[model samples]
Target: MSLDLGMTNAPGSTPRAPGRLGVPVSAAEALRYLTDLGMWLDERRKQLDAIDQAALSAPDQSDREALTHDITVSMALWKAISDRYELLRVTFDSGRVGPVQAEQLSTLIWGRLDVAPGDGREATRARMPSGAESNLAVSLPEACRLSDAMSSSLRARLALETTGLDVSIRVKGIRESVERIRDQVSMMPLGATRDRTQRELIALEQRLFDVTERAKRGADVGGFLGPLEVEVAARERDLIVAASRRHESERDAARARELITALAARGDAIRGLQAQCLAAVTPAPKLAVPDVRALGAVPDDPDAIDALLARLGLVGKALDQAHETYARALGERDELQGLLGALDAQVAGSPAVTAAERADLKPMRDQLAAVLAATPVPLVRARALMAAYQSYVRTVTNNGRAPL
Candidate 1:
């Protein structure tokens, strides 16, 4: 099943508001929400289980420690959300909940409540931090939102950032890139081009050997890894470009050319998306997108073509990450703007909101609007303005009343 479970906000979007269980919550609506939360909790439980297994199997102490902490936080949040869900389910399952009961349910849903492991079997096993009981607390929606975010992040790490295998995987990838370049270089006709390429390969091999030795000895070679990968990828591109220029098998060259063309087109699309994201949000992620055109023409050598294909696969992955990062940023900005607009509308239409109160709220609203309307919206400033507006509206309209 897709891991897009729970009440998760998309990459850059704001989280959806939790269903209100205020006075007069409909039985049908409450039941439907409860059922969905139940399903969400079930999926979350599976996620937590998988995360726990990943923690146990983590490559090293640090990996294990980090994953373990994540597991704890996810679990604590899940339990908090789950507890309120149960309370609501039992109250609503019997039939209609009275006003007092509904008010209490609203508190359970929206109020900041204690969120520690209970004194049960599972709690005993958790062994949470000292005084965790007193320190950790969140509302039901907050817990659900946090759990969704943590699960998504931890899922990514488990898939891509398993530190124990990270170095080996990176080294293997670099090694493949190097071999592919070697194939392209070998297809070159004998002379200065071939000889020079051969010498470069030797140098790359030597560096690869040194990197391998350092890794075995447990030295931190991370600083060398990225540069090495880039160098090999660049060499592969140069070799392909050179080979494609040479007269060779028309069939193989055409195949290579087709592949490169497709990749270049993909690269162009990704770059366009990147540009849109940058324009849509301030403080966009700074990423160097891989340009397939840099690899040059499709070589006539079958082996070299295969190697180029492998390199293209790596490029595709890089582009995917870039796309996700930028898309999330854009989504977040749009969601925040939508939320600010929604809040402004809500306050303006509120029954208790007087003309004078609306006048008082106008400045903050306009400031927030200006910020949102700015090119590359300053999300931080917009968010702050939004919070101030919400707080101010509450104070103006319902100063003595308890917040809903």
Candidate 2:
């Protein structure tokens, strides 16, 4: 005799008692249960179509009602089957469910919870099943589908900042999280804690991936991401800040480019100025400016150019010293003239200077004027005049400070 192990009603009004099948042994066995149910749905769909064909032929109200109710129930069961199988598939991907555990779970959810939804309270309660039912909900495709908004939005936001910032690390994190979710984690023999831990980890990874995609989308994210949610949220915040910084970063880059270009031009200024300044002094054929090769071949990247610019500054300082030397060598006559004129003005205006000190300054001033008047004044004579002027100033200063 056929064993009366269990019974199941048809999708809708067909309340036929059913006999039980043997409990599944492996994950494959569990999959077969879903596959078999899918095949049953196909048959039920045909049954539904046939009922539709009959109603078209005869137009009976009761037949139409039965057809409509059957349609509703068929659609409902199809959705339930799809959802349940997808959950198992997700769980399997995460290394949570092995063969034996999958079979047991198939019995628990499909074989148990998917009973006749006749009573309203029972049907309502079935929709939100607790205890054993909730365990498998996170692995479903709907969970993944629900998270698409965040990932998609985050991807868009990150794309904008790519021109400004190195988002590679974050992008890699997101990609890896997504890949980990898709990858099959280590499938081991069915155990209790291992599955749960793996499940939570994989779920967290998936949730993080979802969180990234959801960034800037502003949609409600649905999943238990655990402590990883903090990471996801932090990453999302980072992406936002990175994106906001992009415009200003680009602007700063443009300014840096201008500065780099200007620094590069300093090479020519340095060479030219060195030549001009060294012309009047000990005329070296070529003054030594340290090789700042990159200045002439400046990089467009601001940070790269900054190092080269610092070298340019050293060259610039040498240029300054060369210019000062040239000024002293070439303008020595003007220098002596200015010293004589200053002394004349100081002697004319001062109360501290005695007549003898003033008379002494006149001869020094006259000597300085004679040196200044000489055309192409010898460099040695110019040097002697400078020393004489400084000595005269010191004497006058001392005489002013001392009692008359």
Candidate 3:
């Protein structure tokens, strides 16, 4: 009898019979079963190695851990397969079966135990579980084995069918749903509201455009004739005032130059008189007048005495004239310095000059003014008359040589 157990049905649905439990064993069958088990083990080992390689090449720590978990699960599945194979080996060896008969017997035993159907169906379901319940129930080792078997079965099934039928059905359903949604959306009043909003936006844009155009025109007018006009007018007024002040400064400088020249001339005359007085006080060289008794007796006469007194009187008059000249020159120098001071005061008091300039000129003017004010009137007038005489001479010389 043959057992056809399908795991899709509930457990104990099929009746258990004795003959269907095991088949006659052969050595060839046993060897074949062992060979198949060995191949499965080798494949599982290769799969574990691949998982290890994936873990090594993983991009992040989390991915490496996931790949290592997969390798551990594959190793577990390999161990399970080895256990099942050993159980089959024990059954076959006790029955004294040939290798070929052992392989058949093993297949029957596995079938009777309902292990083969459970493994194959669970393997397929494990690959792509129905829902969260199947996912929770399957171990990682079982999932790895199921995934390999189900993927191979799916590929074979797909190869036997016509192309693109499943995709066409999905595409049709999607198209219908999309069309229904589009029709419902088209029936909405959103299009009218959108049009109204667009019109309002256009009106606002037009107003903004007009305002920007007016602003551009205002900017152009301001650029052409704003602060620049005021600046130019102010600069022109400043230039005129500066020119007037410059003319006044030039006149003042000329007056100062004339006063300095007069003072220098007077100083020279004073220095010359001082030099003359110093020379008069110096001792003259002595002459030797020995062994001339008659010449010495003639010098004691009255006529010689009267002539010597007249010569001394003339020397005294010349000395008095030189002193008068020095005093007059000094007085004249003080008067000129006073005039320079007055001119400086006028410049300083002018509104055109700044406060700092006035402060600088004021001290110099005060010093010269004090000296001139302290001088005696008679001396000052005499010095003034002398300056007038010098000025007349300079004027005449500038006019070229003439009869005096």
lDDT of 1 by residue, 320-399 (tens): 88878878888888887888777777676677888888888888888888998999888778778878887887776564
Report the CA-based lDDT of candidate 2 relative to the real structure: 0.44
How well does candidate 3 match the true structure in TM-score terms? 0.23
Candidate 2: tens digits of C-alpha lDDT, residues 1-404: 11111112211111111223234435544455445544544544444344334434544666554334323332344455455656555554544566566565545442422322222223442221111221122222222221221222222322211233223344444454444333322322246634764665566566666666775376533222223433443333222222223333455556555655654466566666556545443333344654445446545443555555566667667656655655555565456567667666766766766789778777777776766666545557656876876676666665536411
Between prediction 2 and prediction 3, the one with superior lDDT is 2
Candidate 2 regions with alpha-carbon error over 4 angstroms: 1-223, 241-249, 261-273, 282-293, 296-333, 337-378, 385-404
The TM-score measured for candidate 1 stands at 0.35
User: Would you list the rank order by lDDT, best first?
Assistant: 1, 2, 3
Candidate 3 residue runs with Cα over 4 Å from true position: 1-25, 65-70, 98-147, 150-404
Please report, as a residue range, the 10-residue window in candidate 3 with the lowest summed lDDT: 5-14
Model 3 accuracy (lDDT, Cα):
0.38
User: In candidate 1, which residue pairs get closer than 3 Å at backbone N, Cα or C atoms, i.e. clash?
Assistant: 12-331, 12-332
lDDT for model 1 comes to: 0.66
Selected candidate, larger lDDT, 1 vs 3: 1
